[model samples]
Target: MAIDDRVGQAGSGVRRDLRDALAVLAATPRLLVALDFDGTLAPVVDDPEKARATPEASRAVERLIALADTRVALVSGRALKDLEQVAPFGDEVLLVGSHGIELRLDEADDVLALDADERQQLGVLEQVLDQMAGTLDSVWIEPKPAGFAVHTRLASERHSRVAHLVAINELKAEAPDATVRLGKDVIEFSVRSTTKGEAVEHLRRYTHASAVFYAGDDVTDEDAFVALTADDLGLKSGVGPTAADHRVAGPAEVASVLSLLATLREAHAADAPDTN
Candidate 1:
């Protein structure tokens, strides 16, 4: 369906709520806008490495970055390096990956360091995931800095369930302290305990943002949504039960939201009286 058709399906109440959220974001002195990568800014593809932001979304992001006092960030479950390969935005935008365990701020890069024990545990996780992948057709394991992810997007329902069960059980037995997160057709195991919520809070403090706007599409993003304050806005890109204040159809709608925010912020900046 066309973007306009999808947008037209939104109820009046949702439109009003989105308008109100954009108003608060536009008026804030410093604004932080964080978005999830796959399935939020970009359509989730069969091959994770092939994912890229839609052209419309990319243009909207550029506009947001150009706005004064507005900071844009992509907080994703992919590794920082992998996210960089896909998005490839300039230093003006922040990139948080591996669910906040890895951060690339401006020109500096920060990653979670694993101790000897954690390294050993991660090796075991990789072995277990490899074995599970071997057993299940179309299931693949993605290695990460802290741990690994089992992707079942292309697997049959039965195979996906069995693979996830095996991986989860193995992780519980081998790396009992590992942080496990379940999302759409994927299961991730990491040694670090960081969450997207923590990442959002960190960005908010780092940027000294008066208000924040966060959007995502997966269950993993619920953490970020819950972290939002009264002054902040949370948008769920797709549907299901979510903690986000508003819901949009998919990445297309997300792009529209970004465009709306950029337009509103530009207007607010134009209307502001010059202090100098």
Candidate 2:
């Protein structure tokens, strides 16, 4: 079915694709599922802290975890503690926070802490962020393990652009050695090596994930998209980019995809003739 038809009908293109993907996931014993939190699992919000997973989406992922022989991971630019608070799967899902700078397999205490210089960069960033917040109205900053961000999603488009420019200049001046990056309504600065691509590579190696499915939305997620191989599934959750293997409209569509996957897993299990 076409994309429009899928929206109109219950189990169409999105549902069929999701069913196919889940069949592949269940057929393979070793499956790795990685997702970006904001704008992927949860709707993007002005107050990042207020962002929470939709009940339907959260339940879908939980069902996927329960049914499939898969290891699920939540990878985001947010700090470890912050990502945990926002993620739908919580500690049950492996956490790759701070742009994968901090990782936790099962619990927050299991988190891999940041190094010394990365820690110091946080201090340096705090000063720059404070200045940016002072200058821009309806703008704020979010501090992470190896970086800091200025968010202007709540501000007018003009102020958002201005804040982005100012934040870029200030962060560049403050941390010349650090890599500065931009995202939708946000600007970030972080240490050189802590990137989404590097995070994907590391997670793939650690998990020995023979098959992978990565879903995300945002500029930072591009790193992971590039890292994906032909056999892996790279999904872009929002508008823009024919680059991803699959394109989804928003978090609700993503949830729909996951829910269909859960249903498909059950279908496949029933179809198998053997008890094993």
Candidate 3:
């Protein structure tokens, strides 16, 4: 069920449910807070460089990180360099980029390495997508490490549909084994099949988190949502059919939710018994 829009209300049943979940997550030995950068932490924008996390959301992330047994990560479709450019965070939060094709555990971590075969495949993919965009008004190609995404966010309805159709047909003929993913106004074709779900699972094991709180706002995020289990909470940040357990209107509501989690986590930490 959809909760209150702001999540700033007091004594609402929906609020209580979310509050309880956050409390349980806080009390876990290790809690991993994973989020989609675009449309989840920041408002969706045509110019990706313009997107930045809401102030309240940024504060909440810092607060949660200060608390014991807490970790935060940004799982985004942007390339690692692109994600880092927009996200004003340091090494404090892990970053999973390119829909899990790239992972930035820390600044010192090695970059993604591709073999000769993969490099040749990427070159061909880029050329086809480049041609697709050159022939259509407002169609754009976004480069990634393993593949590229055809962005139709700026295209007219007819042009957008034509771009998608052409991309699909061309991929079937040119790169039959390429993995394709559909998102809001975009279609991504990857040489390597990877997903946000795999990234989240990897983070879970890597951090040894007892519970995971993940939020996202696109169809591709369903891959991550479906990966969630009873110990996890999946939140959808926009209007669409979703596998997420909860829904919010948009980025503003997401900020409120994160702020609430920060509050609940602080209280839970205060109440816990001392192990020492």
Candidate 4:
């Protein structure tokens, strides 16, 4: 319940509160472990394409995937195609990309379709972002299926501020009703409305999970954190401002959390009676 709040730690370095929470979560009839990709599972990098999950994190997720009644997922702000290129585990982990606008449930999942009006709105959004980004150095635009994100991670302080300000104003003028979200050094605009919170709710209902574990690392992640019910656990990775009830240092600590959950879940599954 209390994630980042300091409490006594065991020899394992995990807080007593977290360990107790995990123990309870592991015993639930169904569990959903959903996470944000960037900065949560993979370390945030200047070049988003090169990002990958840490070795320990990969092993931890694999372990969870092997357990019965447990579903693991990576919910991210990146477009599904871009996310697929950098994120680990392929179909082994369920994916909610484009801030929940896209879902890859299985190999047979249908692609997202844009109607005529939505397609027109996206075209206008992309053009505004690309043109605004073209005017600045080290500022670039990333295209998504329903919208685009303006990345200023590589820009100088002045250029970054300018990029963000210009993008916000332009989107306001061009796509007045579009969904706009600001993240760490990134400003995103989408014609279709969605959020990580929506993604979490979707996953929870889809899996019929009695308990959920969610971790994230950015402001956009607040959406997901707030979506969590009391029965769910929210861990914030890295720091700044967050709605998450618990906090972990960064991707490494996140790996530890996952590994711990995997271990606890493994034991619980073993002790579960054979219903067959």
TM-score, per-candidate, Cα-based: 0.92, 0.84, 0.92, 0.94
Clashing pairs in 2: none
The Cα local distance difference test for each model comes to 0.87, 0.75, 0.85, 0.86
Best by TM-score: 4
**Ranking of models by lDDT:** 1, 4, 3, 2
Backbone Cα, N, C clashes tallied per candidate: 0, 0, 0, 4
State candidate 3's TM-score.
Answer: 0.92
Cα lDDT tens digits for candidate 1, 159-230 = 999988898888899889899999999899998789999999999998889999999999989999999988
lDDT of 4 by residue, 1-276 (tens): 232232223117777787888777778889999989889999998889899999988888898988889999899998888888887575778999999999987565778898998899998898888888888999988888888888889899999999988888888898897899999999888889989999999999988999999999999999999999888899999989888888989999999888888877777777789776
TM-score of 2: 0.84
> Model 3, range 1-276, lDDT digits (tens) per residue?
122332346224335676667656666777899999899999988888999999978988888778777889999998899999999787888999999988988456667888887788888888888998999999999888888999999999999999999999998888887899999999999998889999999999988998999999999899999999998999899899999988888888788778877766666677777665
lDDT accuracy of residue 235 in candidate 1: 91
RMSD of each: 4.4, 4.0, 3.6, 3.7
Q: Note the residue pairs that clash in candidate 4.
A: 3-245, 3-246, 4-246, 4-247
Residue 51 Cα positional deviation in candidate 2, in Å, after optimal superposition: 1.5
For model 1, which pairs clash?
none
Better of 2 and 4 by lDDT: 4
Give the CA lDDT, 0 to 100, for residue 239 in model 3. 93
How far residue 141's Cα lies from its native spot in candidate 3, in Å, is: 1.1
